[model samples]
Target: MADSVIEESDYIPGKDELDWGYEEGAEWGLLFPEANGDNQSPINLNSREARYDPGLLDVGLTPNYVVCRDCEVVNDGHTVRIMLKSKSVVTGGPLPSDHEYELHEVRFHWGKENQRGSEHTVNFKAFPMELHLIHWNSTLFNSVEDAMGKKNGILIIALFVQVGKEHLGLKAVTEVLQDLQYKVTHIQHMIQQYTVIFIFVLQIEEFRRLRSHVKGAELLEGNDGMLGDNFRPTQPLSDRVVRAAFQ
Candidate 1:
């Protein structure tokens, strides 16, 4: 919302200090159907802080384009891909090579539902469509659903987009969706669906100073509470999908 990611303050905030809208949203964009994810912030096993490193994320580098797929935010004529990871290209890293997780596709989000759709979850709240840097835990977990069983199977960073102004930087994603025909249009895009992503973090100081300006602060009160009521924390969606798709 503030165009900033969370900075680690040695001191955690009071309940008041904590509100909805994690800064990581700006680091990535939205979650679409075509990709796997790496949501490491909320359940940080390696770091004691349990948050994403703002310094290690770059919003522009994640999914920069989206094809018009008519899934959630995508239409049918456009394509989007993030060209941010220079290190991966240089070393040709598969990324998180340790776990065998990979990048998939990118999408969009908003403050209002259907008005928006998102990837990550925080306190049971989902945003319009927060981008998910989705990844799989290759070692112990066979699939993304299986990994959600462990505390470390998946890593999702939840970022909230404010409602006052248009996200100009996000326009590239929206414009392409516009060019495509709605309701069964065929869009083409080259979003890298592979393993590994190189993230560039934002400065925490910039976020702490700017949090005051983000609009639509009712996230926890509105969407989050509703989600907590629907499912068990970290429960597998396999049962749900299987039941729905087949039944």
Candidate 2:
């Protein structure tokens, strides 16, 4: 783990002997029993085993993320997070018509130089990095904190990241890593990494528009690495059915 990026509370040294329960450990069950539950996330996505449903074709995502110049970014000891202050929303996409979810925050996980860091895997193949964009069902919940642990209260969009040409949409945020180097977590003290949201706006708007035309699997595909391996091991997928849309 990078001492410069992670908070002392959330930092653990070796992957072979991880101290954090959020990683590979049994202690997680003591805090979040759901960690041992059947519906835990970050499961393996086996394409061959997934069920194709024509009806799922209608399940879509319509995002309305606006450009903002005054958004907040923080190093929450766990991950670097960017809070979306705009009333950005994602409709459809496995949600009921009445369930409208608003963008909450965006965070990422990455591994060391040679290690794969993605939380979810495709056929056991890990990606170098992953972006988790968390959302809350605002139509049903008054606040994101109130929706925690509630069924159908939260929605997380995971995107595998690949390293190649500089991602224009990620530049604005990533360029500020130097400023946030070794920043500790202070819930009341959220340091602003960037004053502008150019790349941030581009990323959300592009993905939102692309979702209406592309299948979920395609949109979620890619492989890349970033900082030290910060991803949790893939959890068991008990009684969970992987569904996808097929033409």
Candidate 3:
């Protein structure tokens, strides 16, 4: 938790977090209880990067990650799984428990270059690498960092590197290069750690494509909650009023 560490005061959720999901929105409304619920932005979002979150880099990246070791140009290979070495870190959440859970595993995600570094960031700073240390919020000695700093003090770390000069650790993840559809959570097959091998990484275009596909598909399905009403939609003004609301 070296990188994951904060003074305990930085946990405040941002406006995006406050306006985030339905559950979060419900909680947020309790405070600004009378604030306008109406949304005017395209797609009802207040901003473009509304869903892009740094915290997601911890939880949303693939967990049941697999890697490859065989390669021609640079030791290319298929996905081979590496087991996570288990040990505890500091654990203290809303409940009891000294040591949370152990360091689950490590992975990586890189881009073609620096300006587009990795997908995650802290305070908008982009480094050569963005390491992610995944520990159970539920485990701990001292806190989670205790287990995190044990080795390199960085377990479940994310290393961001340039596209050139192949990486040895990444061979474990990139080998399974084929992008098959992932329908369910991959944690149960978590090798020696949590359910994932490692991220093979994606280009900026690929990322945008993924986002578009997801958004388009979600809209097509018309999730009942997002759409609000499948059975009844607002009628044209003629049906509800003698004239219009102002008229």
Q: What is the C-alpha RMSD of each candidate to the true structure, in Å?
A: 16.8, 12.6, 17.6
* Per-residue lDDT over 1-247 for candidate 2, one digit per residue giving the tens place of the 0 to 100 score: 0101111112121113233423443356665444566566667888887778767657666776656455565553345667766677788756767678887777766555323767778889986667776777898899887766666676776787754444655766555554443334213223232222222333332222211111222322432211245567676666667776752
Off by over 4 Å in 1: 1-97, 109-129, 137-155, 164-168, 189-247
Highest lDDT: give the candidate number: 2
Off by over 4 Å in 2: 1-27, 185-227
Model 1 vs truth, CA RMSD: 16.8
| lDDT of predicted model 2 | 0.55
User: What's the residue-level lDDT of 232 in candidate 3?
Assistant: 11
Ranking by TM-score: 2, 3, 1
Q: List TM-scores for all candidates, in order.
A: 0.31, 0.72, 0.32
Clashes of 2: 7
**Per-residue lDDT tens digits of candidate 3, residues 188-209?**
2212222223333342222112
lDDT of 1 at 236: 20
The candidate with the higher TM-score, 2 or 3, is 2
Candidate 1 weakest lDDT stretch, 10 residues: 238-247
